[model samples]
Target: MVDLQEQAWAALLYVVLMLVQQWIHWIPGDLG
Candidate 1:
């Protein structure tokens, strides 16, 4: 059970990181 919970958290963090990276890529042209 604990292992599964840890895996879920890891997956969620990975997805969040991916989204943040994409946002950073998209934000530079108009604002800067």
Candidate 2:
């Protein structure tokens, strides 16, 4: 059970990280 929870958390973290990258890429200016 603990292992499954860890995997789920890791997946969620990865998704959130990707979304943040996309969000920055979409924004205009020097941050991309």
Candidate 3:
């Protein structure tokens, strides 16, 4: 059960990081 919980958290973090990266990339495009 603990392992499963850790996996879930890791997945969530990965998704959040992906979104943040995309947002960061978009900012430069918007500025230009």
Candidate 4:
């Protein structure tokens, strides 16, 4: 059960990180 919970949390963190990266990429002047 603990392992499953950890996996879920890791997946969620990965998704959130990806979203943040995309968001930054979308904003103008963010490339610098």
Off by over 4 Å in 1: 30-32
> Native-vs-model 3 lDDT?
0.91
Clashes of each: 0, 0, 0, 0
TM-score of each: 0.80, 0.82, 0.76, 0.82
Q: How well does candidate 4 match the true structure, expressed as C-alpha RMSD? A: 2.0
lDDT of 4 at 16: 100
- In model 3, the clashing pairs are none
How high is the lDDT of residue 12 in model 4? 100
Tens-digit lDDT track of model 2 for 3-31? 99999999999999999989988999975
Q: What C-alpha lDDT, on a 0 to 100 scale, does residue 10 get in candidate 1?
A: 100
Q: Model 3 misses residue 24 by how many Å? A: 0.2
Please give the lDDT score at residue 30 for candidate 3: 58
Better of 1 and 2 by TM-score: 2
Candidate 4 lDDT, 1-32, residue by residue in tens: 59999999999999999999998888899566
Better of 2 and 3 by lDDT: 2
lDDT of 1 by residue, 1-32 (tens): 59999999999999999999899898978775
In model 4, pairs of residues that clash are none
Clashing pairs in 2: none
